[model samples]
Target: MLYAIAAVILSYLLGSVSFSIMAAKLVKGIDIRQHGSGNAGATNTLRVLGKGPGIIVFLLDIGKGIAAVLLGAALSGQSDWVPVLCGLAAIVGHNWPIWYRFKGGKGVATTVGVMATLAFIPALIAGIITILVIAITRYVSLGSLVFAVLTPIILVIMEASLPILLVSLILGIFSFIRHRTNIVKLWQGQENKLGAKKGQ
Candidate 1:
């Protein structure tokens, strides 16, 4: 139990290292959260810093999620739920990072890593749907919301463990809550689409 607790805390700390913020500072000497959508995320990275840095930040953020899960698995011993909980902790940390003054990115990229690691097939299916939505509508936030909302349903259909399903549900709720502003903009047709300019 002590090991599990330590792993969870470690995972949160890992997630708190915002790659977007680091990348922005390294590449442009700017705080990413002060530009674009004022979001410390890959989408804003893409908008502010362009493709290469954005992709790098995305991959790094995903890697953090993967590392957290692996850390949990290594320390969990017989508790299968520890890894899932650790993944959730990582997402929570990404959303409200201690290192970044509680200002952090939405957890979509980290969610991708966590869900894909925990339940591959279901996550893949939901990922495909999300990509399709993004490709068709160009709304990254919408795609993210779809991915969050659909993964748990897919997990339930696949007969995943209750703990995993519950975690996914919580993640979905967190995604929606974090994206509340985007949801409003989407309804008002004022949300930014992929490839749109920073202020467009």
Candidate 2:
């Protein structure tokens, strides 16, 4: 129990390290959350800082999620549920990073990392579908939503562990909640595309 608690706390802290915000400050002398779409995420990073910095932030955020799950597994002696819980904790922290005054990204990239680690085949399939959606529609938010909504169904079909399935469900709900504004904009045909200029 003590180990699990420590793992959760450590994972949260790891996720709280927003690479987008740090990269923006370092490269552009500005807060990423105040620019582009005012979102501390890869899409906004791409808009505000260009491809290099955006990709860096995306990879770093994914690394945070992967690290959290691995760390939880290690600290919890490879317990079945601890890693899943820690992964969820990391996603939550990504969405509301403590270091960033509880303001942070949408957790799509982090969710990708967590789900990939938890269930590789299902995640890979879902990811392929998501990329296809983005390629066809150029709507990153829609791709993200599709990934979030489909991952759990894939997991259930693959007969994943209860804890993992539950975490995926919660993560899906969190994704939808975080993307509420994007959903509205998409419905109104006002959402930005993948390569649109900043402040679009």
Residue-wise lDDT of candidate 1 within 1-200, one digit each (tens)? 99999999999999898999999999999999999888888899988999999899899888888889999999999898999989999998898999999999998899899888888899999999999999999999999999998999999889999888998999999999989999999999999999987621
For each candidate, give its TM-score against the true structure. 0.98, 0.97
Off by over 4 Å in 1: none
Model 2 lDDT per residue over 71-138, tens place: 88998885889999899989989999999899999998999999999899999999999999999999
- What CA root-mean-square deviation does each model show from the true structure? 1.1, 1.1
* Model 1 Cα shift for residue 124 (angstroms): 0.5
